[model samples]
Target: MRITGHHPLWRIAAAVLGGYAFTWGFIALGMAGAFALGMSFHDAEHLTAIIGFLIYLVLFLWAFAARSLARVWAVTAGGALVMAGAASLIQHQLT
Candidate 1:
């Protein structure tokens, strides 16, 4: 049983590392948006943290089940950037 073809390693990496990055971005955006929308700091933090766990699970599974590694990487990495950037903008506006 030599499961050594295609890009299993890449998929695993994306599932773990990429998923983590994407989840982090999601948390950042959620925190900022929630706070800006009048949520308490601790409330927003706890809320986003809870949602982020579910998001990470979904993304991890999707990364493995998805057919296109490129798309997975793109979405995870690109989405992270976009979300983080949005969070940054929100923070700037709030400040």
Candidate 2:
């Protein structure tokens, strides 16, 4: 038998995976952005930590509310990839 609508397990899975991606995305982008802006390591770390927390909450809720599991995963993964790419480009320029 196949399940219909939004499965609870899938929602939970999306939340877990998306949460990690969100964190790593924030870490990469935040660090890179901070560095590009010339902020010191200590200051940038604190800034990113705070920003990550707020973003995670929003993403967590969004994951559950989204219509489909695939949509959530795609958006989450896409966002993370974009942020990571931006970080890489910024870092490259810095070096």
Candidate 3:
């Protein structure tokens, strides 16, 4: 679980790629939730996009700093799946 002994490539991939997936899911869920709450589409998207950038930065840094690569991957990947699924459900409801 220690990040140091494992290949740095894994850490970098977790940081960049996993962070992107998590951030994308966050944006999608945030936008959908906000829109469901009656926010304008453009406003919801803009707000969520801004928040997603900050979330991605945090996730990217955490990927390197965390002691467990498995935990990092699980959180990012699992969160993405759950959030994206919620977003899809919200979108279906909206439609």
**TM accuracy, model 3:** 0.94
lDDT of 1 by residue, 2-35 (tens): 3467579989999999999999999999999999
**Candidate 2's residue-wise lDDT over 18-91, tens digit each?**
77786788788898899789899888988898888888888889887777778888878888888888888988
TM-score between candidate 2 and the true structure: 0.83
lDDT ranking from best to worst? 1, 3, 2
TM-score of 1: 0.93
* Candidate 3 local lDDT, residue 44: 99
* Model 2 lDDT, residue 4, Cα: 61
- 1 or 2, greater by lDDT: 1
RMSD of each: 2.5, 2.7, 1.7
Deviation in Å, model 3, residue 12 alpha carbon: 0.5
Give the true-structure RMSD of model 2.
2.7
**Pairs of residues clashing in candidate 1:** none
Whole-model Cα lDDT of every candidate shown, in order: 0.95, 0.83, 0.94
